[model samples]
Target: MKKNGEMAVRRPDDMHLHVRQGELMKVVVPQTAAVFKRAIIMPNILPPVTSAERLERYRERVVAAAGSASGFEPLMTFKIIPGLSPDVVQELKQAGALAGKLYPEGATTNSEDGVSDVQTIYPVLEEMQRNDIVLSIHGEDPDVFSLDREEAFLPTLRQFSRDFPDLRIVLEHLSSAAAVQAVAELPNVWGTITLHHLELTLDDLLGGELQPHYFCKPIVKRPSDRAAIQRAALSGSPKYFFGSDSAPHPVDRKHAPTARAGIFSAPVAYQGLLRFFGEHDALERIEGFTAVYGADFYGVPKNGDELVVRRQDWTAPDEVGGLVPYHAGEVFPYTVIPGWK
Candidate 1:
């Protein structure tokens, strides 16, 4: 083992993450910044980031909130909805958007304003294709049962892939075997696997007493689903990489009546993931998954920066910014020494 069990790699990026807005963002952005060089900030805020101007404003808020955290950057994305103009899509690209995220109507948090029919946003998607903006997908059919939602939405991705052969589409936070296969086997398509989805299953949420924190949109699936995801993560597939999809919710909201659907994994994202990859003996691929591939897919330059991981074991902070983080109160085998500026 390296002295003090320390290893380093090109600094990674959280390809998909949610830092909410206002005060919550202040509380959570640093946790991610502590480990990642950049992250794709989800735009499903209260009103949602639909326009380039709004996206810029949100980016500014996020940049300021992150506050001189070394070289950390927040790559922004816009929420797609019906009737979005091609002109608006161009404006978003000009505003430095890495992609445009699609949330099916009523599918997840603040998605009531999302697309009811995928076709409704074809104009925007077409424009994105022409302009080279990646299309990030929330691959779940709201009408399907919670467990089956992600798989149910696969056909739509297939159709869209065929319809827009040149469009770059990323299936966000895949949660099922079917979804893993779709992204693994499909053409011109890619998928992001979340830490929670890869590690937790329905049983983790309901096996003993109700573990409310385990609940999330497209709720964790079967052990088979998790195993399949693990295979993909460890398979050394170039198409698959890291994206934490670390969505956070306030402790009150997470533990309350009807709870919310998200996991605040930012704080433990690095250490937890390092532990996971280590357990599988797939640690060699960590840098490619966390730092290289997503940047390659997004057409951005890989960060020249690097993150050093110490073999030291540490317990993750129980709460970050007043909200309970994923793996809260749990110990992990590794901790990041966060070197980049």
Candidate 2:
């Protein structure tokens, strides 16, 4: 509750997050674990977590990185590939996979192995549906123009909704007004609004000097799209929830001739969301967007602890884990108070 210049919110759960392996994971996991009680870890690293064995091992690494002090729970997921058997789906469920990520081949980073013909994985999808595992899609058609990719994928998403009537599908990182509206209209379908997508437009990426840091797959779209995302996030709709999609890349990779598509927002996700919601005069709804709704959608309980942010200004770090962070160097209206009881 807001009183005397402090707002206490339920400890959030980042429904979408990417903590890369080894050194990078060590550098970024704490930033998220410090604030979010739990996070759905993305399975798109090199030699992606495609099997139950890999998922278990990756989850261990994430847990080891997060440590016990913060009590961070890494909810694991498997990568969906062609010819994955129904037996493997059961194996993953037994291995603690909360979801499975579907990336259209050539769609994004390390996705060279992603599904080329989504229909080829129908058996796997049907198995996931039976096992009650959520399907998280990167909602873009590789054959379409960059701007039209997400909208172009709408038909496929609609098809999924029809085919797997009971399957819970999350249109990861919603990038357009049409996508946002589709998720709202479809039953058992929800959309994740990333920290970068909620505020960025194509202009932010290339309207003037090219800002490579804002470059991401399903690239941020028009201002109208941004407005629609903001409306969905602020509307306190359970169908739309927070998923930082906080993918991190080294500075050199981001600035390379072929820059990667990701924004390392885990470090500033909570602070940025607090400032955004406060500015919108919807501070009370922040809990649902950041913490409650996502957990409810996953059939998990809300975090019992509260994270208190004070009306104190703090500038975001210019670089986090050797990557430029979202809103780097910009001042935020609120900052998290360490060790909230």
Candidate 3:
């Protein structure tokens, strides 16, 4: 439904996003739902969406939020906790929840309720394997490697794949060379790279200019590590896909003395990628990263909806709906011209 010759492209899915809950959800959900046909919603809510009943309620709320927006009907996928029993996994799968999300405790915001030990949830893993359910991992061991958790976590996750060959595992927002290599080598393992990590490096963190917005769990790595991630994302491997991991925090929270870490890139994610691709002369390969690869990796159907990325210039809001805003006052080179039916 886009204008002719406008560089329209199929709608993209956000494999990872945190739309928060309640008031914050009301403000931010529309921006993402407008662009992405579906998203793997994060489970790190205030109380944590750990039970089937809570997940159902959360899904209802998300649906209600979407209902208020015309032409926007984004699918909400529930992220399961690792503590659920095997029976619970079967029940949720039968009822059509998308997949499970495993957050190692203390890994990031609101993740205190996440699984403290992976071994403690073996029963749930068994059920997920039996039910053909996908398990999305945060990919860090809370205790062992503070700054280098990805290096410490990949081996355990690789072992899990070996133990449960049938279970689909997605390593979310992978920021290390080891993670990229593990996903490439493992048959059932898939990995997602976020736009923030794809573009920045540790020096950015150390310099403290971008600071909070650039900070995130399994924190950004050295420049060489980022180069490895960039290579893997452009590698055209089916298992390497895109996930914005577009977490938004209020401007006040972001600019505070103890600012929260997250980047709200949903509104401009594709444009950012397109610019990167265009500069790299990989514009033609954008489809692999934006649409095809993620669907194939997750076994979800490609979205029938389409959008356009025009060459028009636009500035991202300093604040949208009273949220602090992502890249708060920066300008970008492209815009996502949406035309959802």
The TM-score of candidate 1 is 0.97
User: Between 1 and 3, whose TM-score is larger?
Assistant: 1
TM-score of each: 0.97, 0.98, 0.92
- Which is the winner by lDDT between candidate 1 and candidate 2? 2
Worst 10 residues of 2 by lDDT: 1-10
Minimum summed lDDT over a 10-residue window in model 3 is located at 70-79
Among residues 3 or more apart in sequence or in different chains, the pairs in candidate 2 whose N, CA or C atoms overlap within 3 Å are: none
Two-way lDDT contest, 2 vs 3, winner? 2
lDDT of 1: 0.86
Per model, state how many residue pairs clash.
Answer: 2, 0, 1
Worst 10 residues of 1 by lDDT: 1-10
What would the TM-score be for candidate 3 when compared with the true structure? 0.92
Candidate 2 per-residue lDDT over residues 1-341, each given as its tens digit: 45688877788999999999989999999989999999999999888888899999999999999988998999999999776777899999999999999999999988888898877999999999999999999999989899999999999999999999999999999999999999999997999998889888998899999898898888999989999999999998899999999988989998889888898899899888887888899888889998888998888888988888899998889987677887889999898987655
Q: For candidate 3, what's the RMSD?
A: 2.5
User: What's the C-alpha lDDT at position 235 in model 2?
Assistant: 93
Those runs of model 1 whose alpha carbons end farther than 4 Å from true positions after fitting are: 1-4
